[model samples]
Target: MTMTIAFAGTPTIDDAPGIDWREQAACRNHPEPNLWFPVGINDPCDDAKDICVNHCPVRETCGLVANRTRERHAVMAGFRCSDPDEFIDLRIWLGVENPARRTRTCRHCGVKFSTRHPRRRACPECRDLVPLEPVHRHIQHLRNVGKYTLRGIAAASGVSVGTVSLLAKGQSPYEGPYVSRAIAARLFAVTTEQEAKTA
Candidate 1:
């Protein structure tokens, strides 16, 4: 995750000056704590987004803090942070990224991104998540040779459905061109049932 200087000028926890808002978090006592710290696709933690985005009363605060800290891990207020810009994007959406920062919707991901550069079209994360041909080949292999459904592959591989869909672009199971290096490695490592049986 790209690190960035944060908390430079933002509101922290509202309960107590600098106190964290974890206590009031809807996921405070969630059965699966690992949902927030999902590592790559091994534990997609898809439900974490719902909790952070919908159920949590402090979702706005959560997004603010995540942006303020430039956190790259976990689901913060429904935004999957893959880069410093995502956090900044959230801050920008909240109208607090920076005094001088202007917001633009990422052409690739469609998320509002904070930018001082006029030519920037996609968010930092979306820009870095360019698709790879090899990964697309693997997707084809999963569907054709392995007889694996996209959902099945996602559940088995611990990769998020969105990641798989992103790689697929829009043509069903493989069309677009945007998968991050981390996603590529995770997807490349996934094996079809045929290969598994042979092994």
Candidate 2:
């Protein structure tokens, strides 16, 4: 696959006539491109994350580009290149640090679409139909009954701390009105007391 990644100086092949978000990328002109790719290993896990999470304004767009072009294991998005076969294997791919795009069928409408998120199983309109109250109730149970903090729940549930925070606030910032079924399953599966570390 020919990927025209508009990273700093690189020319993009699919200039679909919009503002170039790449210019705002924090990794622009970095000394080592592998600091982001690290296709050989998964060690660039920390500092790079700081750049994307703290500085990059176009982090979402960058991941979208990577997913759109199928950049073949490149860590254009926040996905860690830790596992050697991250490109070939999907099982090793985990939560929170999710980025990049892949094609998935919506479980609700049976519509196929491109998504950069691993948890997005339904289209936006159908996403609301997925019950989120159960997930929130479980989260509350974990917090109130189990005495776990939001961060603790985030760690155990494989969901982001920000997502957990939003859910507590009766908001779903990353998702529509609900989290994906996969995410819900993940939250429900966190019965381990230790995994749900106390704050």
Best candidate, TM-score: 1
Query: Please, what is the whole-model Cα lDDT of each candidate in the order they appear?
Result: 0.63, 0.60
Instruction: List candidate 2 segments past 4 Å from native.
Output: 1-10, 13-18, 81-199
- Per-residue lDDT value at 10 in model 1: 37
RMSD of each: 11.2, 14.5
What lDDT would candidate 1 get against the real structure? Answer: 0.63
Q: List residue ranges in candidate 1 displaced over 4 A.
A: 1-20, 41-43, 98-199
> In model 1, where is the ten-residue run with the lowest total lDDT?
1-10
Clashing residue pairs, backbone N/CA/C < 3 A, model 1: 41-158, 131-177, 131-178
lDDT of 2 by residue, 1-199 (tens): 2333235434573344677666677877666555665533313445666787688887666655554455554565565434323332232232324567789887644569787655666665444334567877888888877798999988877677876787777675433455555667767887647654752
